[model samples]
Target: MPRSVLVTGGTSGIGRAVAERFTADGAGVVITGRREHLVESVAKELGAVGVVCDAADPRAVEALAARFDTLDVLVNAAGGLGAAQPGPEAAELEAVLAHWRADLDGNLLSAVLTTTALKPVLAPGGTALAVGTIGSERRGGSYGAAKAALAAWYAMLSAELGPRGVTANVIAPGYIAGTGFFQGAMTDVREQALIAETHTKRAGTPRDIAETVFFLASAGARHITGQTIHVDGGAFTTR
Candidate 1:
């Protein structure tokens, strides 16, 4: 039988690409998104089940978990930068707190809550993956902080899940294009600057990350676990 896979925030960008990859592989894929219409449309297009869910919401995640009896792969791709916030000097303390909280909830808690809720359903030799960013290594602000924390949390999670034969890891991407991640705020100069940082001299694509994810879920990768795999085309090198 094909593997049963679940991808949160799979309606667009890296998440959508991951879902499509699995769908093409004949996996029994289920994708979740916050918008009903988009989820329905994408599900029909990909021939995969689509769920309308906010992965960060505990109740919604629980409901999502209830639908699956056994899951072979879980990909938490439901996070992004929160709305732009005013500078500390301009914004009130309450506003700052709210912004930070939103980032943590969306980026960190979404993975944590979903993993916890579905832990029991994860089958032997299954994999749990999260989409992270290279920003977590450098000048990333609140968003980066959350991603960093996700890696830390997954270290412990991998230890806990190891005996159960489930692996956990994070795939951190750098300067990916066509993800709307920059939200139309990118300039030619900025884009070139980013591309120059990579040894490949090209922007990463959603497909790049998707291929990494696919490999990690394969039997060949069963020995790999509890690590952050950067897919940045050498923008951030590891020693």
Candidate 2:
């Protein structure tokens, strides 16, 4: 029987890449996103099931869980920087609060809620991987804070699920290219500087992260749990 894989935020970027990888490997894959149209389109394109769901929304996640009963892999790839308000209103206290909450909800809470809701359906020897960011290690912005908390939460989660034969881990990426992450906000100078920081002298790719995710979930990685694997091209290194 084919393994079942669920990837949230699979409409684009890293999520989409991960979903594609699993589908190509002959897994029964399901991808979810907040937009119904994008979800449907991508699912059709990849020949995987697409679910319309907001992972941060408990009710929506609950409904998403109803669509599947058994899962061998769960990839939490739904996260991004919160939107900045336009004009002077961006500096308002309300705007700051909204941004912070949005980061928490989108990056941190989304993974927690979705994983919690689907915990029971996860099979033994399964793996749950959450996409994190190198920003959390140095940059102290709202998104970074949320991702930092996400790593911390995963530690506790690993302890809870380890005995059940599920492995929980985080994969943090830095300066990845070929993604809408920058959304046209990147400049030539900024891109050059980012690449220079990496020892590889090249930007990372969505497939880079996707490949690491595949390896971590493989049988060879069954002994690996409660770890945060950095997938950057030497941009951020541990001492």
The candidate scoring highest on lDDT is 1
Q: Clash number for model 1?
A: 0
lDDT of 2 at 2: 95
| Clash list (residue pairs), candidate 1 | none
Q: Model 2 misses residue 70 by how many Å?
A: 1.1
Per-residue lDDT tens digits of candidate 1, residues 1-239? 99999999999999999999999999999999999999999999999999999988999998999999999999999989886466666658778787898899999999999999999999999999999999999998999999999999999999999999999999999999988787889999999999999999999999999999999999999989999999998999998
Q: What tens-digit string does per-residue lDDT give for candidate 2 at 1-239?
A: 99999999999999999999999999999999988899999999999999999888999999998887799999999989876554564667878888899899999999999999989999999999999999999865999999999999999989999999999999999999988877799999999999999999999999999999999889999989998999888889996
**Per-prediction tally of clashes:** 0, 0
For model 1, give the RMSD to the true fold: 1.9
Once fitted onto the true fold, the runs of candidate 2 whose alpha carbons sit more than 4 angstroms away are 84-91
Those runs of model 1 whose alpha carbons end farther than 4 Å from true positions after fitting are: 84-91
Assess every candidate by TM-score.
0.96, 0.96
Clash count for candidate 2 is 0
